[model samples]
Target: MGVGRILLNILVVLAAIAGGFYQLKLKPILVKFGQGRVIDPRGNTDCTTVPELKACEKLVLHQPSGVVYLACSTQESRPHWLPNAQRFNATGASRTDYVASYNPQSGKVTKLKTVNFNSPRGLSLHGMDVVASSSNPSELWVYLVNHREPLSGDPKVVGADSSVEVFKTTLGGSTMEYVRTVEDPLLLTPNDLTGTPDGKAFWVTNDYGVKTGLIRDLDLLGRATTSVVYCHETEGCKYAIQNMHGNNGIAQAPNGTFYVVNAIGGQLTVLEKQADNTLIITDVIESDRSMDNASIDSEGDVWVAGFPKALVLVYEHFANPTKVVSPSTAFRFSINTGPNSFYGQKFKVDRVCDRSSYTLSVACHRIT
Candidate 1:
């Protein structure tokens, strides 16, 4: 072959190698990041955007009263100090983040006053749960993932000194009393939590094992270092399930089955609680978008809120939530008792609602 012909052959070889790399490596990463995927928007007609509620990262409902408790902060603040997203501008973080309740029946939103809880940093809210008191139906137990800045160190360096804060409130009362803060090393980077009715114990999902590092970012690209930590008031916090990839919000069903969201990978992990309070993974439900939080309703259907465009959510919406619109999609997962159940499709997934907003958590009021 001539010199020009040999050069042409070399160029062809390089092109083939690049094509293989794109298919085997880069494509999966892009898909995981929700890039270039055609979004078929569904269930957009029924969602009603409450202009009063903005920038709530988590929501839990008091089923008996049809009240939804929200872990909320101003949209202006989340861009600066959302630790899970690694935007650790502590000075810009909201000091007055609050828990509010929305009554579907009355269509009234109330910001539950924090009584006797005086942390200097106030509440930098994230994932939360509001469980009815087992002993008294009139009382409610609130479990919050508080992402307070580190006491003695820089938040950018150490990440948020996150903890599960337990509180109590009445059925229809406006005041919520602070009980105690459960802080431990095992609460590495708590993203979301599911609490017991008594409020003495809870299971929190640590979205990242290594705090404030490159490894934490690599977790998006399949690093299985995230975990679920089980914390008790007296026993402290311990890892119930470890080496999980992209663990985010956790919701427990009425039957005691737990559904954990994989924030990056777009999957739901079904976990069963053991006798020792540890969780065993029983099944996985796959999805196409990145999910943030999961909530189960009175009927035992699991509802998940996800980002249709992950890049827009992280880069644009979180930065300027008011102006830029990031589409949020809610998925409903229920046991497939239909004909598909015989084909081994155990769960039926439906896109119940989709709207343009920074939706981090979701709760279903009815099956429709």
Candidate 2:
């Protein structure tokens, strides 16, 4: 064959291969990842961005007092040391992160002051839960995920020495008393948690089995190495559910059922607690967009914060949150009691809040 003809044939073969790969592999995956998805702004247009609550990740709403608790940090610090985001520059991480309460009715915001919390590395806050005391009406238990930088190791190499910290505070009060820090080897890469009312035990999500390096990033490609750990003061910690695909935020219903949302795969795994305190998967609900954290309401509905555009969130927003704003949405998953319930619809998923413009930034990292 002539040299020109041979080169042309080679180009044709490469083009055919690329076209097949795009159609078979990349297209389906990107569609599942929420690429080119536009959220409708009809009944879901009631969301307003609170300027005071920037980078507040997880939120727990107190049904009695109508106060919302938030685990917050600055946007600048999040791109530096969020372990889930895989940005591990600990030197730039915020050490003075805080928990704040916002009253929707009164339009008041209070930063709960820490008392007797003397950790040298301070609080690199992430996921959190606010549980009311079983015995006292005025008392509340705050479980916070503190991604504390290791004291004597490179954070990029060793990852955060993550643990769940328990704090005691009064309802609507501005101070939180440091109770104790719960640390276990199983507490690796702790993300979000749901705590017991007695403040003695909790179940936390390990978003990754391995702490640092390439293995941790395997979750991006649909790996199932994350898990949930049941931690108690005396019993230590153990895995409640292992080999979870994308464990992120977890919330417990009043009836003891747990709802866990995934970050990359966007699966909501519903779990039921067993007799031995471990959890078993009861059902799995799928979402069109990737989700970060989840919260249970007073009426037993699960509210999840979802990322509408995965590419913008992963590439643009996290890289420069202040400059670029990614689209966001709020999903409510509840028991299907409508007419569709008879048609084998066990649950109803609704997009309660949708913000597609730059005004509302609701990426996977922060919600509320």
Candidate RMSDs in Å, in order, are 2.6, 3.3
Tens-digit lDDT track for model 1 on 1-368?
A: 89999999999999999999889876776676678865666666666557788888888877777778888899899889999889899989998988888887677988899999988978999989888888998899999999999988877888889888889999778889999998899988898998898879999999988789776777866889999999888888788999999999899887779999998888999999999999999999998788888888777888888777888888987898878888778888989999989999999999877665445445445622
Best candidate, TM-score-wise?
1
**Pairs in steric clash, model 2:** none
TM-score of each: 0.92, 0.91
Model 2 residue 98 lDDT score: 95
Off by over 4 Å in 2: 1-25, 43-45, 358-368
Encode model 2's per-residue lDDT on 1-368: one tens digit a residue.
99999999999999999999888866766886777787675444354457788888787888787887888899999889888777889888999999999888778999999999999989999989999999996899999999988877887888889989999999989999999999899989898998998999999999988988887766776779989999998988999989988898898888879988887877789999998888999999988878888877667778888777878888888889899878777788889999988998899998777776752322221233
Give the range where candidate 1 is weakest over 10 consecutive residues by summed lDDT.
359-368
